[model samples]
Target: MLVTPVDNSEIVAALDAALDGGPAVLPLSADDPRAGELRVAMAPDEPTLPGTAVVVATSGSTGAPKGVELSAAALTASATATHARLGGQGQWLLTLPAHHIAGVQVIVRSLLAGTPPVLRGGQTFATAVASMTGPRRYTSLVPTQLLRLLDDPVGLEALCSLDAVLLGGAATPAPLLDGARAAGVRVSTTYGMSETAGGCVYDGKPLDGVRARLADGVIELSGPVLASGYRRDPGGTAAAFVDGWFRTTDLGLLAADGTLSVLGRADFMINTGGVKVAPAAVEAVLVAQPGVAEVCVVDLPDEEWGQLVAAAVVPVDPARPPSVAALRAAVRARLGGPATPKLVRFTDALPLQGPGKVNRKGVKDMLRGT
Candidate 1:
C-alpha cells in the first residue's frame, strides 16, 4: 500500500483489502529513500502467512529496514485487546501518518468499532479535535505531538475533551507526562513497537493476553498480538523471535507489580571512558529544563575517551539558547558526570527521521557539519 501524500481514502481502501486476507500490504513512506530498496529486496512472488494482513517497515535508523509481517489474526487480537483495555471501542482521530503501526492501528480499531476515524491531514490539530463527535473518543500520539498540542490553548482543551490520549512511538520524558496529566489530558504512556502490533502495553501494564518479561534487561514480548516475523528475512526474524518471545532491542525492567519501565535501547547505549550511558536518560533531563524545546543526545567519536557524550539542543528561544553549563549541571545532578554531555550544540530544530522521532544519526552528522 504505497502510503504517500497522506490520503485517507487510499489508506482506508488498502487497510480494507488487507483485513480481507488479500496480498500482504506493504506500506512505504513517501520520503524514505529506503522505500525503493525495500521494494527491490522483497520478492515479487514472495509467499507470506496464509492470513498475512500488513507488512510494516521498521524505521531503519540503525541499519537496513526489515518488513514486519502482521497477520489478520494479529491485527484483530491487537485491536480487540486495545478496545477491551480502553473500556470500549470509540472513534479515533488519526493524526499520525498511516505508514507506521500506530497510525494503522487507529484505522483498524476504528473499523472494529464500525466507525471511520476523524482524518486530521492538512488541518490543524485543534480543528480536527474540535470536529470529533462521539460518546467515547480516543487518539494515539507521540510525545512530540502531545507537546505541540499543549502549546496551543484550543489544542489543549480539545485534547482534554477526549476520553483517553495514548502517548507512544518514543520514550516520553517524565516531566512532559506530569505536565500533561496536571493539565487534565488523560494521558496514557505506552510501550511497544511495530513488532508487537503497535502498543501492547499501556501505562506500563501489558494489555489483555499480552505478556512482558525481561531477559538480561532486554524486553521480550509474547502474545497473540505478536507479528509473525520479518518478511523475506529469516535471519532477522530468528534473531528477534526466540521461544515464542519477540526480543526487542530496548532494555527494560518488569516491576514486581507487572509494570514495565523501559530504560533505553540497547543498541543506542554510548560507551564513554569505560562507562555506558543511555542517551534517553540524559535527553529526559535536558528536555525538562526551562527554555529547552527539544534535544537529541549522541556519541561523537573521540580520541581520549573512545566516544564522548554530545547533545544537539533546540531551545525554545533561538535568540537566547539555554545555558550550556546549566544543561550539563542538570544532567550531572540527575545522572552523574559520565552521562553529562561533553559537547552541546544549539540548533533551530532537532533533525527528525520519521513522523515524530528524532534522527540521532542525522543529528550527529549535523553536529559535525557533514
Candidate 2:
C-alpha cells in the first residue's frame, strides 16, 4: 500500500498494516513530485522481499529516488535497539514528516511502547511539546529545527523537558550541539539513514547489534537493522550493500575512545590545486563565525584549481552581512589557505532539499549561474 497523506490516522493505519505483514507500505511525502515517479518506477509487477514492511525512498545527494526495502525484522530490530539505547521505550512526539524513516521510526517506537505518538502539525513547537504527556517523553528533529527551538525561550524550555532528543537527518554542527547541551537539552546526535531503518548510531556509538567500521576512509555499517536492499535496483544495491556491510559514501574517523567522527561524504571532497578538502570541515568553521546563521560549502569549476572552494552563507542579520575577507581569513587561520572559500556569496537562506538538509548541489548550480 502506498501512503502519502501526513494525517495521523493515515500513518497509523499504514504502520498497522505493515506490522501485521499484510501489504508492504510505501510512505511518500505529500509535497514530493518524485513520489509519482517512484510509483511508476515500481511498475505493476515489481518484486520485493516477502518480509518487506516498508519501502523508504532515498534520492541521496543526486539521481532518481530509489525505494529502500526495509523488512519487518529490520524495523523491529531498529526500534528495539533504539529503546535499549535510550534506556526505555517512551511516548514520542511526531513532528517530522511521516514519510521519512526518522519520522516513521517515531511511530514504530510508539507502537512498540504500546502507546500512540502525540501528533503535531501547524502548532508552534513549544506548544506542541508542552502538550505531550506520559512519564518518558522523546522527540527527533533535524539541526534546523533545533536551531529554531533554541531561539525561542518557550521552545527551548519544552526541548529541555524531554527525556531525550534524537538529532539527525544531517550532521549537527558542533557549536549547535554544545549550545543545546548548555540549555540542559538531552541531545543525542544520531547517524544512519533509510537503509539502516533510521539512526543505528547514537552519539557516535553503535547501538546494540550494530557494527560500524572504516574501510579505507569510507564508513561501512553492518547488523540486523539493515534494510533488505534497494527495491528493483540490483546494480545500485550491489554497489552500496556488499559482503553484509552497507558501504556509505561518508568518510569518518574512529577515535581511540571508540567514538566515530564523520568527516564528510567522500564524493563531496573538493580537490583544488592538488589538495583535497572536505567541505564539511570548512563549513563547520564557517558556521562558528559570528552573525552567520547557516552556510553551504561547494566546489565551483575553475580552470586553474580544477575546482575552487565556494560558500553560500545565510547571515543572521541580512543588512549587516559579514565581510568576505574576514570570513576567508577565519577559515584560512583554522584550516588552511586552500580550504578557505575563494568565492563567498551571501543569501537570505540556504536552499534545503529533504528534511532540512542543505542542497549543496543546488548551491553550486546557483553559483555557476552567477
Candidate 3:
C-alpha cells in the first residue's frame, strides 16, 4: 500500500488510529523535502512490515533520508514500558514534531494512557499545564529547551510542577543537568534513538524489558521495544539488526550494577596525533567553565597531526567570553594535552540539526572554513 504522510494535528489523530490497530502511517514534516524521499522509501513493496504502525525518518542532517519501521507491538511496548518506568501513565504534552520518533511516541503514549496529548502550540508551558486534565502529567524536551526554560521563572515553575520531565534527543551537559535538578525539576536524561522507539534507557538505566549490552565498548540493544527494521532497505536492516539485537553506533560502558554510561559515538571520536579523544568527554570538561554556555567539539583536517580537535563555543556572555587560552588550560588540566582542543572559536550559537542535537558536522565546517 502507498504511504500517506501527515503532520501536526493530523499526526496525533493518525497515531491514535494506528495505536487502535489502524493501518501503518509514515509521518513527515509538512514542509520538509524528505517527505517525498520517505514516501518513496515506504512505497508499496513486497515483504512490507505486516503490523507496522509507524515509519520514522532518521535525522537526515547528513543528507540522506531512511525510514525506521516500527511495528504496532514495538511502539505499544515502548509506551507501556515508559509508563511503567515513569511510575504511571499520565497526560503528555507534545512539544516536539511528529515527523520525529520522539514526537510520534508522545502521541502513542498519551493515547495508550486514554488521554489526548495537549500540543504546545503557541503557548507557554504554564498555559499548557493549565489545559491538562490529569493530576499526573509529563512533558518531553531536549536539553536546549530545558536550558531556555531555566531562564523563565514561570516556565521553570511550571516544569517543576510536572511529575517528570523527560530530557533527550541529545546529550545533556553536566551544568545543564545539575542546574535543572538544582532548580527542583524532575528531569530524566534519556538515551536511545529512532531504532529503539525513542528512549529505551532512562537516566543511564534500561527500562522494564529493554536490555543494554556492550560489544567491544559499543552499545547493543535488544528487547520488545526495538524497531522492526529499516523500510525498503534490507541491507541496512540486516547490518543493524542480527539475532534480535540491534548494534548501535554509540560506545558505552555497562557498570557491574547494570548502569550504562554512553561514551559518545564510535564515529564521533576525534583522532589527533595518533591519539583518540571522545568529544563528549572533552565538551563535559569545557562546558563546566564559567563563561561557556554551550559547546560543540569536532575534528578538523590538519596537515601536521592529520586531524586536530576543534571547538565551537556559545558563551554565556558574548562580551565577556572566556578566552581560548583559558579554555585550553581548563581542558588540559582535566583531560590531558591530546584531548585539549587545538582551536577554539567562540560564537553566538551552535547550529542544530535534529530535535536539540548539536550539529557537530556543521560546527566542524564552520570552524574549518575560517
Candidate 4:
C-alpha cells in the first residue's frame, strides 16, 4: 500500500480480495528506502495464501527482519471488536502513516463498517472533521500528535467534537492525557501491536474477545485478534506465540479488575550499576514539572556505574528552562536516586520516528553528543 498520495482504492481492493481468500497483500510505504528489501522478505509473488490477508513487515525496529502475517479473520475481528467497544460504527480519520498497523486498522475498520475513512492528508483538523459524514467520529493518534494538537485551540476543539480519540504508538505523559480529557476530548489509550492486528486493548482493558495475561512479568495477549505469527520465521513465531498467547516485549501488571498497567518495554529498561529502572518511570516525574513539555529518558555508558541515567527534555519555555538540578531532585524525590538522570539535555522537540512516536535511539544519540 504505497499511500504517498493517500490513495486507498488499490489497497482497499486488495483487502477485499484477500477477505475472499485471494493473495495476501504486503503493505509497504512507497517512501521507505527499505521497501525493496521488505518486499523481498515478505514475498507477495505467491499466487495465494490459505488464510493470510496482510503481511506487515516489522523489521529493524525490533531486532531482525520478519513479517507479521495477519489473517483476514484477525483483522475483521479487530475492526468489529473496535466498533463494538467504541459504541457502534463511525467514520475514522487517518492521521498516521498508512503502512503502520494502526493506520491499516483504521482503513480495515472503515472497510468492515462500510464507511470509508477521511484521510487528513494536508488539510487542517477542522477541515478534515467537517468533511466526515458519519454519525460518530473517531481517530487515532500518538502522544506527540496529541500534545501538539492540545496546544492548538482549533485542533483541540476538533478533537473534542469526535466520538472517541484513540491514543497509542507511544507512552502518553500524564499531563497530556489530563489536558485532553479536561478539554472535553474523549481519549482512549490503546495498547497492542501488529501481532494483534492493531490495538486490542483500550484504556488498560482488553477489547471483548481479547485477553491479557502476564507470564513472568511480561505481557501476553490472546484472542481472535492475534496474527497467525511471523510470515517466514517459524522459530520467531514459536518463540513469541506460545500456547495460544502472543508474548509482547512490554512488561505490565494486571490488576484484580483486569486493568493492565504497562511498565514500559522490557528491552528498554535502563540498567545503572545493579538496579534497573524504567525510563518511563523517570519521564513520568520529569514531564509533570513546570518547564518540561516532553522528556525521553535513556541510559548512557559510564566507567564507574557501568550505565548512567540520562534525559533529553523539550522545555515548555525554551529561554528559561527548568534547572537540571531541580529536575534531578524531582525524579530522585519521586522515584529514588537510581532513576534520577545524571545528565540532562534540552531541545526544542524530541526526534520523531514514525508518525507521532519519539525516536528514543535518536534521543540517545543526541544526549550522547552532550
TM-scores across all candidates? 0.94, 0.96, 0.97, 0.95
Which order, best to worst by TM-score? 3, 2, 4, 1
Question: Best lDDT goes to which candidate?
Answer: 3
Ranking according to lDDT, highest score first? 3, 2, 1, 4
| Window of ten residues with lowest summed lDDT in model 3 | 39-48
List where candidate 1 sits over 4 angstroms from the true fold.
1-6, 31-34
lDDT for each residue of candidate 1 in 1-370, tens digit (9 for 90 to 100) = 3222235567767787778765567766665667667666654466775577887777877887677889889999999999898889888999887888998899888887878888997888878887777668999999888988898898999999999898998778777899899999998988888899999999989999999998899999999999999887889889998889999889998889999989889988999999999988899999999998878899999999999999999888999998999999999999999999999999997777665777888999998889
Give lDDT for model 2.
0.86
What tens digits encode model 3's per-residue C-alpha lDDT throughout 193-231? 999999999999999899999999999999999998988
lDDT of each: 0.85, 0.86, 0.88, 0.85
**lDDT of each residue in 1-370, candidate 4, tens digit only:** 2111224556666666776776677767777788777776666664323478888766355465577888899999999999998999888998887777898888888777778888887899889988998878899999888888888999888989999999998888999899889999999999988999989899999999999999899999999999998876788889998989999999999999999999988998988989999998999999999889999998888998889999999999999999999999999999998898989999999887765667777888899884
Alpha-carbon RMSD, candidate 3 = 1.4
Q: How many clashes show up in model 1?
A: 0
Model 4 ranges off by over 4 Å:
1-7, 47-49
How many residue pairs clash (N, CA or C atoms closer than 3 angstroms) in each of the candidate models, in the order given?
Answer: 0, 0, 0, 0
Cα error, candidate 2, residue 333 (Å)? 1.2
TM-score of candidate 3 to 2 decimals = 0.97
- Name the better of 1 and 4 by lDDT: 1
The best candidate by TM-score is 3
